[model samples]
Target: MVSFIPSKQLTNPQTVLPEQLVEALAHETPLAFQNVEPFRRKSALADGSQKFLLRNQEGKPVAVAHWASPYAPHSVREAIARVNSAKQAVGASLAPHILGPVGHGNVQGSSFGVFQYQYPLSENKFFWPVQRAQITPHLLQFLQEVARVTQVPVPTSEIETKFAAPLQHLSLMEEVPGEIRTAAAQALCRLERGLWAPRYVLMHGDFWKGNVLLTQKQPPEPKFVLIDWAGSKVQGYAIFDLIRMAASFKVKPKRLGENVAAHCQILGCDIRDAKSYLLAAGGHFALNLGCFPLERFVCMMQASVKDLDKALAATEVN
Candidate 1:
């Protein structure tokens, strides 16, 4: 029997940054030093990684800074390494320039890591082109290059273990109706069975439109820059990244299959084999939904389940 924990206690508490930390950031970086007010933005994680838009003396946004609560030194290290690796693999023009660590100190009894940041073009109202003709080739190039540097052999056991978390969660969720739970379980089982013969590559674990930044509105060449490397993994399914990216832009599932086909052609994967990867990727999102705070939990959960159902039907996976 799976015992339920209260959702409120399971959620990570929000951490407010001190004026001292903001002042310390200005001193550490090449920004106009002052008691400038920082604008807060919503972060993907609830782990108190506070993202703030720091403005200069003229009140122009200069840089963004992410201050991590609970002091994840390893995460900080990985972020630096991944950013540098990606920069080398792609180029400085297409990757966020990490300005290095800023400051680390205690905030509200929790230790934190203050890190420098980059101003992405997306912040200035830039978005990717909706047309596949313009979007596909550039995205493909970026994904291929990123995979080239970061690919590593991962054990099948590790992949299976990672995929199982969601299934376990769904089995224990009393709130899920019986039919939905049964269908989801069956889909997960099919996915697990299908993924036994796996292919691995380095993945921008959370690859989506939001993390991709465009440098120009009009193009002779549209410069694409990737940001937020903390969630990256060396041995990950490439198809997972592709699926997430398509979903991020609200591409229809049928259209997503077309995108998937193009991705497979570039990476040399059989299109027929993409189903398991898609389902497994959906499972990851579905399982993680409950872990998020209540505000985003239901909406994200519904979207994930919808994606799973679409993929299952599109692929005709029993």
Candidate 2:
């Protein structure tokens, strides 16, 4: 049976929960460890979900609890689905183990809550790279593994729904620039005819160094665990994830086209169609990741698309 945390009002400075609620969460949740205290809290500004880090009697970090209000049932359901999909795509070891909406009886009356074991402190602090240049080949390989596992064949008939809709929606958004819309329309034209990539893969939606947790126990071949899967998708443009990883790591706009070309190779898509992939990824970002109103995403697209030809052409050099 699954349990849930009761709906409670969060006070000011969203990250800091009320002391009384903290005490209740520590003892009432299913994985309720004894003598536990919350050391940190973060409230997702965009989604209103609350996160708490709890430690046990020995003063070692033990678990994390994530809570959402009953009013945001979609958020709770989506989070649960995304986490399960990630585990299936990347294996249980590479994904956090999510436990119940753990609570006492009256599950229907409670709000949504989930708990997960905390990764090792050292791994959290030092395992993942701090800079784009510091990203290791093994880490890249791990990302590839995630992409590889989630690939699914897309039938020609379903192309419009799966690949073209997002780009179409992006093209129609007034917030997007004219040239970007033109680029999206061109990509949509090809995708509508079933002419671009042949398969769709699950996208992490926000794949970045910060979202990845690395375990260095194996030395030189560290394993990774992904978290915060609230926005993950079972079938989306895979290149979006790759480009997001690069862009989030602060890769320059001009260099992003090159990264897109490389990611095409990784995903078994045609390298010659890298431009189409970039537009599709941009569309996904705008439509799916709530980047339509974000100027940074727009500027990045404008700059990258402006230099894309030169960048990709340069890559063709010996």
Candidate 3:
């Protein structure tokens, strides 16, 4: 447990951490900064929140903190939800241990939280798409563990609302290509008929390489820690996570389909049809990833549809 002291020199205008956030951290968490300056990172988007890497007096990295803008209550809410969702899934074994919220002042203005981990995240080397053949199996194992803990029976109405409705909406969008829209329409019809609606598992929702942190630990010891659980769901299509991971590699569409197929086998999911997997994965992403702009979402959906088409065509050729 580290003791914190808010230094006057560290409270200047150019400081990345807000004064309120600093106070919250001093009072709420056991992080010590004192004369140490935090390494700050602004959000890639205009989300008006910033992340800070706090260090101890000895210059050892200790905790990560997030400070949200006054207007971004949703960001704060998502932060809280992310912690709760991770805890509900299987506690700190699969994620960074939650240090709890800095203060309950999210709605009033800014919000803050801190997370501490023993091993530093492998920030640089985890993403090696060229070696996907070796990396994908570990990712599949992580996904299977997540599903094993979080799987539950989802009702049809929930499926329609969560997946089919978003797909129907996408199908009507003019910005989306005809092929993608047609595929979306077909997927919606299948949902209505109860196809691709069963065997729901908790989806990481954004299971890309960036969100996955590999510790410097050797193989046989636990190394993977999944972060950013804002989009996790108790009842979701596991194919969504599988496809998202494949897409992050920027693999060709047919290759992505093959990866998902192989991953599905590992998870014991029976989704073999390329079109069926595409529909379910696409619909799940379209519905839950509201952080993406409509245009961006449409573009992703178009690309995904094309990839799945290639995958299906390749399957037919074989």
lDDT of each: 0.52, 0.57, 0.58
Q: Model 1, 222: alpha-carbon shift in Å?
A: 3.4
Candidate 1 lDDT over residue span 249-270, tens digit each = 5556665655566555555545
Each candidate: RMSD to true structure?
9.6, 5.7, 4.6
Which runs of model 3 end up more than 4 angstroms from their true locations?
1-20, 35-47, 90-108, 117-135, 217-222, 250-259, 262-291, 307-318
Clash number for each model: 0, 1, 0
Candidate 2 clashes between residue pairs 3 or more apart in a chain or in different chains: 3-101
TM-score of 2: 0.71
By TM-score, is 1 or 2 better? 2
User: Best to worst by lDDT, what's the order?
Assistant: 3, 2, 1
Window of ten residues with lowest summed lDDT in model 1 = 1-10
Candidate 1 ranges with C-alpha deviation above 4 Å: 1-23, 31-35, 42-46, 70-137, 147-153, 156-160, 163-196, 215-221, 252-255, 265-269, 284-290, 293-318
Residue 268 displacement in candidate 1 (angstroms): 5.2
Predicted model with the maximum TM-score: 3
Q: What lDDT is reached at residue 217 by model 2?
A: 33
> Which TM-score value belongs to model 3?
0.74
Highest lDDT model number: 3
